[model samples]
Target: MYRLVVLAAAVALATAEVILTLHDCGSHDSIINSVRVEQCDSEPCIVHKGQDYTVHVNFTATRTVQEAHNVLHGGLGFISAPFPLQPENACQGSVTCPIVAGQTYEYVQTMTCPTFAPSITVTAKWEVKDENKQDIFCFNTRLQIKS
Candidate 1:
């Protein structure tokens, strides 16, 4: 009976680890009010080897957001090398030069999961900056990928 109880407890703990969550880390700016990963509602989003995902963000910027930088990092913390991402225009080919203050941004991007994408957790971080390169909004989310 004791062995059975120990095994049950171990199984429960292992199950709990699978349900990772994307949460807010420290932020220098408060422009980003909320972020929701449409794919994953209550659990860590899972990405297939080759698939696309949509991320919706609601923010209230005090000033215009001109350009943004994105960095993809592995789950092993900052010591690991960051994946390279091409710079993207914040406007997304819209006529708007600068994003309006009180607006929400919806971005749909292909995961482009590498051929050797490890079956591990990863975080994608985005930061929008003004002309002075000062951060206006920054956010990150954790997700799991299956290679």
Candidate 2:
């Protein structure tokens, strides 16, 4: 019974991805279709300390690109704090380099929560940039950190 319960929990966690109410930021180009966060079933996703969370973003590209970069931040409002992203190169992570114009793409990345983070409500924004360092698209969502 214990093994069954543990296996059930693992299966649920593996398939749980909440459709987030994503907010748009001023963007250069690209249309965001949807955003999903792991282990969240509603708005203001709960992120546990020292845990890994994945975000999947679906968008349509409006222009051709040779390279793409990932930028992430955690903050309250205007007080933005940059979060260090592993494999900052989006092309290496999810996107393929030399992206075609008018093509749709999905960006998937894993985020590791800082163990030192306070249990507080904060907003996280992620941006995929082009070769010229322009925003392909920018989006934000609310999160609650727990210890």
Candidate 3:
């Protein structure tokens, strides 16, 4: 009986570790998009004030959950505005495809900026949370917005 209990306890611990492994989703990948900044476009993209521009944040993630989701939340500090460039809208509007667990998903986030002029500084903080609102992982990226 003692041997059986020990064996069962070991199996349970192993199973728990597998279930709680670090699973991440988004632009930063050590083997893939590990560069300081995932650059999009030729840089110095031009746009007018009060207009929206799409900045693509490239990333990669190891899929651990059956369905993985990515979101982009950050601040855009321009010569004028120091807060977020857009309103507080969940980045769910940017991604659509489903990410498989244990797999690597290379993706790009197309974020909308409410208004930017001349040149602005863009900084993004991202978090991947499970369906239960548990944070699976986090990542940060920064870029210089030019127009």
Query: Which candidate number has the best lDDT?
Result: 2
Q: In candidate 2, what are the lDDT values of residues 77-102, reduced to their tens digit?
A: 68888887888998898889887879
Q: Which stretches of candidate 1 lie over 4 Å from their true place?
A: 1-22, 25-30, 83-87, 93-95, 102-111
Write candidate 1's Cα lDDT for 1-147 as tens digits. 999999999877554423223355533333555666544544556777666554555566565555554445555576544554444544543214465565655433323556567788777665555556666556666667786
Task: Compute the lDDT of residue 128 as modeled in candidate 3.
Answer: 47
Candidates 1 and 3, the one with greater TM-score: 1
- lDDT per model, in order? 0.54, 0.86, 0.41
User: lDDT by residue for model 3 over 1-147, one digit each (tens)?
Assistant: 999999999877543311111223432222233322222332323333454444332334454343334545545553223335232232344433353434444333334544533365555455545454544345544545544
Cα-based TM-score, every candidate: 0.62, 0.87, 0.40
* Cα-lDDT of candidate 2: 0.86
lDDT of 1: 0.54
RMSD of 2: 3.0
Model 1, C-alpha of 143: deviation from truth (Å):
1.2
Q: Ten residues in a row with the worst lDDT in model 1?
A: 15-24
Q: What ordering of candidates by TM-score runs from best to worst?
A: 2, 1, 3
Model 3 score (lDDT)? 0.41
